[model samples]
Target: MTQSPSPTLPGSRAQTLASAESLVSAYEKAGYTRAHPGILQLAEPFLDLSGEDIRARMFLTSGRSGEELCLRPDFTIPVSRDYLTSEVAGRPHGYCYLGPVFRDRGALPGEFLQAGIESFGRSDKAAADAETLALGLEATAHFGMDTPDIRMGDVGLFVAMVRALDLAPAWKQRLIKDFSRKASLAQDLDRLSLATANGRPDYQGVLAALTGSDPKAAHALITDLLSIAGISAVGGRSIGEIADRFLEQSALDASATLPPYTRSLIERFFSISSDPLEASATMRSLAHDAGIVLTPTLDLFDARNAEIARRGIDLKRITFSSSFGRGMDYYTGFVFELRDGTGEEPLVAGGRYDDLLTRLGAPEPIPAVGFSVWIERLAGGAS
Candidate 1:
């Protein structure tokens, strides 16, 4: 059976386009140069960098040369790629874009207009973060969302908390990786707390044998086993990835559980939800009482809050949720979403993704942050 057509917002296409254009104009006035990246992009970058949530929704195709390609899912990666090849790559630059991005939205439209700005190479992280937030608010204001509900998070702070925990290296990596998935992260915490155990019962023997073995040796063994069984790959995963998974499983099996206090600390940290300033104080206090050093991350958080306050944005409008994440893995610090009233969907969303440039082939890390406006959502909600 053929699939049904995707649904559009309740408005004229022309009106939505106009709204997008106005948003882009606002970003340009704020010093972001207009960028128009091609619709088709190399698929590998998006597949690798955008995380599994996006990977599953991507509208993929193949180029004439058999190289995988896809419609631009979002402008951030494409825009970053364009900046990297420019003459001023690695230097501070800002870009704004407005265009259609493609993804599989089931009943919703698979293609829609998106407008936003990306700032790269900024060293003043706190100031840059504040600027991104301000620009996002301005975009919402353009649609009469003067006091939209703001939901904020900081992946950097989460990373700091995980790093300070007393746990095995593999466990720490697992927790950090699972942070974007609330259910998975909670399950991991349960496992760490000995409240539950997870593993494939069929692979119990193999996991046990591999446990405490040299990682390299285990990987090689798994690779050799897969070869012997004539299994070159499984579910699009490379043999190397499969091997790595086995190694990770073995590590997790060996570790089994964490210190009880560690789990309590993580639970407390994730439970924080308050205004930005209050959240910062609560985090600092939690760290101090737990004897873990989250001062650096907390200080940066305060600095960014101070910058936001200095710009005259009310702290009361921002709600900082310690467990909040954009579900995209690339966001390294300061993620946020702005919605009309308490709507479930955000009209605007973005975050800082510092390591994305380096992962996309930059010689070194470049600090980056930005947000995207959903033109259709804004137009639908506009008075």
Candidate 2:
């Protein structure tokens, strides 16, 4: 069988390369150093660091040398790995790169240059989140957009609320992963509840068994659950793999359940204004009255609002919503998407992924966040 090429991809690779260079120049001017050792990278590190959705979205290949490789879809993972493995550790570093990332399409195969930065080894989360947002704004402005709208959300609060509810870790993970996708989350919750009631060890039961302080017991229980669930270690994580993680990690406080309207309200928040300051106030009030003790997330929200205000961004020109979660599995806090005024798809998107670097084997957790503007979309809309 013969397959035809996709027409949506650029006819000339040079155009993509040129666009990528422009983005690279913009990021570099904003203090992101260039770090292009090699355009190609070992795919697994990126897949491991990127959220599940990103991994799924990539176009992978196997080298003739028998190593698995991929055309990099996002730059942060490779940038992080390069920095961590290099002499750049123990000190803060920022690097930007521009390169083509490949993705297969049945009818619209495409490749585009991705330009972004990874701020490594810094734990000032507010600073990191702010810098990422600032860079995105700067990059957009450099691209000549007069007033690129920015929308934001906080996944840390979302996770905190989930943990505070005292849901089992497995249930929490499943719910967290699906929070942005309402129908799937609802269905999974129903399915897990059914499994728990039927005496089969669903994800929640697996989590409950491993929630105690005993590491040995947790490992044994996880092993048994894996065997029972018929899941195996693929790429070093079984269905039970994250269960063991639950045991090793300190449990979150459960003194209060987050407001019932939290999730639904988040949806509404996204539906509202892009005015950063106004959004912060709305979120604060919601968290306060809901008794969610939003203290942990409020600072970042305030900082962002203050930044927007400081920049003299028109509150009326932006729409802010407390509930605009972009449904990635790894976002920890300060999530957002820059949408066209019509609000269909995010032209630029990212947020706090503090825990992701650690999950991918950084010695200490690196509080990190960066946004990728869909260059093609941005350029297309402008044209």
Candidate 3:
């Protein structure tokens, strides 16, 4: 069974509820219609789109028919799923939600209130991105956090850099998949730079033998070997999965070493972290120096900054770190977190996730962006 938060003092609970209501009211007044996604949601979407961190933390259960279900871990996926099934699925719409999101936070409470807005089908990507960040700041202000620390990043910039590089399709996918995972991304960089199988598994000989061979034949050979060894499976991985891993390894083994210049360019790109405007200039200069085209992505970045400034938000207060990510796979563009001075956890966080609606089953891509306010965190800081 899933655990809920322990009972709080009535006064404290009431105050938190009031704060959530106030946030919901604020979002609604800003033109978002209230949305109440169900408490119990299908688990597969979260398992697929939220990445490993959320999958491990979700409180999963099986329905009567054996379908996997989970207490909603976050509002984004659930809200998107709802929108996909609603009449306004493909139309421009804004949704605001305030409710408990369940997750296993170790010593932290398993359940806590989250309030936020989701704006879907907005084609004006830059303006939408700025609006989302501006609203996130407003959420902090609502909790008396007048100037919360704003840390921002644009994953699209990293994606564009990787795309412009001369890499095999598999390597490009691997690098992009590892972007949200800092440690994994570092290991990838190290392996690419070293161009050696130094930290590889002991089965390097097998990978070497399979390198440059036909993938289907290689898979068949591995399956046959496993069968001959009377091993139908290893650990929890099936024969197909095991074969796929070997194929991936073989492909990696066959690839040429990444050129030192290319590696240096990637490293330089990841090293950028500064004021949004300054970061934009640095990125443009880096691209120009490297003879790569990143104009479209950088233009959007600058336009987003311009939009934010137009809203009267001080650009100097926003810190954009190229390597920073929210660790969620669905965020495709700008991401950010707002934190009070006293705590390490963010009181408000969000980003642009344009592909999520289509991933959830829309006919075509619909632009989406939003943020969530951690009511409990804000209330705790206020107290």
* Total backbone clashes of candidate 2, pairs 3 or more residues apart or in separate chains: 10
Best by TM-score: 1
Candidate 2 collision pairs: 156-332, 266-323, 269-321, 273-319, 273-320, 274-318, 274-319, 274-320, 275-318, 275-319
True lDDT of residue 38, candidate 1:
93
Residue range 103-180, candidate 2, lDDT tens digits: 554455456545667776666666676667767776666556657776766766666656655455655776677666
The count of backbone overlaps in candidate 3 is 0
Task: Report the error of model 1 at residue 243, Å.
Answer: 1.5
Model 3 stretches with alpha carbons more than 4 Å out: 1-9, 196-228, 232-235, 381-383
Ten contiguous residues with the weakest lDDT in model 2: 250-259
lDDT of the structure predicted as candidate 1 = 0.86
Each prediction's number of clashing residue pairs? 0, 10, 0
The positional error of residue 177 in candidate 2, measured at the CA in angstroms, is 3.2
